[model samples]
Target: MSAAHNASYLSRIKPGWKFGSLLVLSIGLYLISSWQVLLVAFILSVALLASARVDLKQLRAPLISIVIILGVVFILLGIQTNWLNAVSSVLRLLTMCLLAYSVSLSTRFSEMLELFQQVASPIRVVGGNPDQVALALSMTIRFIPELKKVYNEVREAQHARGLANNPLAVTVPLVIRSLKIADETAEALDARGFDSAPANH
Candidate 1:
């Protein structure tokens, strides 16, 4: 609420500062964290989360997903015969989840497209189709949340009918709906000019 706090939050929201810090943190933590150096990642994640200026409301989905994943991971890890390995597995999963959250919080869709374009340049020179590749990536990014919502709706409907406990209750409907969406999207794209052009390469 104070002016100093407000200013610091605004400063952290700047694009360049966020990207530079993420780059350094990702590389540094990735290198050292592989050797079980948790402090490096812990420090970086703490700093990144601290600097975040956005509303926590925007983080609801990721936070919920992380909680669900961590819950399942811990349950599975508990069933593992090796206690040390189980603990390590859970810790590593949580750490990776945190780092991914940091990246998502700081990065924008445009930045993601730019990064993917640059990374795909070499493959594009080869036999790859960057346009289609980018399209798929963007579609996946956009559709995943939509799919998740659809899944939740379907699951809730199933639960109301006493089928939620059934494994098929959740998966079969999700897959069927997703397939329908994919097929319709492909048909629409083809109806346009997506795949009409002759091969350039």
Candidate 2:
């Protein structure tokens, strides 16, 4: 993930506060049924990303993917329900997605890890290791961009080979490469004793 501009005001905010606000806003989006309000929210979300000085170049692929998915959703909802519901759903989701990307772009990975660790601390009461939980969650977030890169690379290679029309051509390599990456990450974490509990003093 690209780091936010150091001088950006949003970069100075605490990760916990940003994450909390994102959670609240996401929940609130579901309660909103008016497309007009959602459109305003979408505008504000874009403005938030701009205020954070997020790199739009880095977001190109993800934004394209989101647009495609949203398009499909719009068509399906419009047919299954009503055009109004489809418009509201699309606006709500797009706004939430932009808001989420804003937070991720503005926040540092280390700060996010710290926040996740704190939030997962309660998992210890149920025989779960908070450190592992935090690491898993943090790594998952980190993997998103990596996976996107992998997908693009695989897709391009398939396209060059004239297999662009074959879904399996893309799916097989992407899954294989993703698994390879996951395996390597697991090995690295194990080498660092990431899964081991600290000994009593």
Candidate 3:
């Protein structure tokens, strides 16, 4: 998100509280089967987003992705069951995604790392390394936007070459770019001695 977005009300809220609320609400979304409830949740999310004052232009990519994903889900569910089931499922999933996107956009990268470490603390007893866990989680969260950029770049290139409708043209390059990112990430971790265990001396 742009620096201007940081001034938004939702962005100014404490990251922990925002994340916790999103987590709980996401879980609740899955438990409720009523389309009315899902529709209400979806509307609330949209209102919260507007209150955040985020630029609608910034949302274009994610909104497109959401439509594509939910369109597939709606089609599959319609084929498997009924239109009512499809609509409810798609709305519930979309609501959860919007809530997640809002939180991610609002929260800073450092706040996300701290939140992950806080969450991982309880798991330390079971051999978890909070620092590493936090780094991994933060990186994964940060990579989402980067991935979107890479995908758009690839799509534009393919479009220029008159392959805009070819799924393989997009998927192949996206996968390759993602793998390259993973490899670079591993190399950076290695350079930081991530693989070294604490000395017992």
Candidate 4:
């Protein structure tokens, strides 16, 4: 399980405020060209995450992946431009990713749903349904974890059979199971009369 699923003081903050803060920081960091400033921001972000009690172990894989990717990008940028610019760009990206992860770790799914609905509300005036949009967003978020679990389970079964190197060995069953889940979900929704509901006036 992820540290994001746990409750914390950061989770208790208003979603709108948190979103705004992250947006401002991301844009500000992106526009700045100073490697020193970006480095400081990354360090401070790590310190802030520590104070907020996010598990460093839970984040290790993602953090390392980001570093590896950035290292490649930095090498390319350095060859094309200069070392200073490459370093600063990588720092900015690292800072933005860290802050974004921090926000996700602290936020509840319900809070995320409400935030999406609020952001989507303007679409209502343009004949789009904010409620439906928010529902879709929430469902996607909820199902992603389930889908990951299913994929892992399938992968393990294939590995046990010594078919791990076979692409079809993993994907065929995954696709079939995913389709079955979708069908079941549609049926459940229909049984609940969601499809039969009358349009709002």
| C-alpha positional error of residue 91 in candidate 2 after TM-score superposition, expressed in Å | 0.5
All candidates' lDDT scores?
0.65, 0.86, 0.82, 0.82
Best by TM-score: 4
**Candidate 1: residue pairs that collide:** none
- The total number of steric clashes, by the backbone 3 Å criterion, in model 3 comes to 0
Lowest lDDT block of 10, candidate 2: 1-10
Task: Give candidate 1's whole-model lDDT.
Answer: 0.65
TM-score of each: 0.51, 0.67, 0.63, 0.72
lDDT per residue as tens, model 4, 2-85: 345556788778879988999999888878887888889989988778767776676888988999999999999999999999
Clashing residue pair totals per candidate (backbone < 3 A)? 0, 0, 0, 0
Candidate 3 on 147-177: residue-level lDDT in tens? 9999999999999999878999889999999
Clash list (residue pairs), candidate 2: none
Highest lDDT model number: 2
Candidate 3: misplaced stretches above 4 Å? 1-4, 127-201
Worst 10 residues of 1 by lDDT: 1-10
Q: Which stretches of candidate 4 lie over 4 Å from their true place?
A: 1-8, 134-188, 195-198
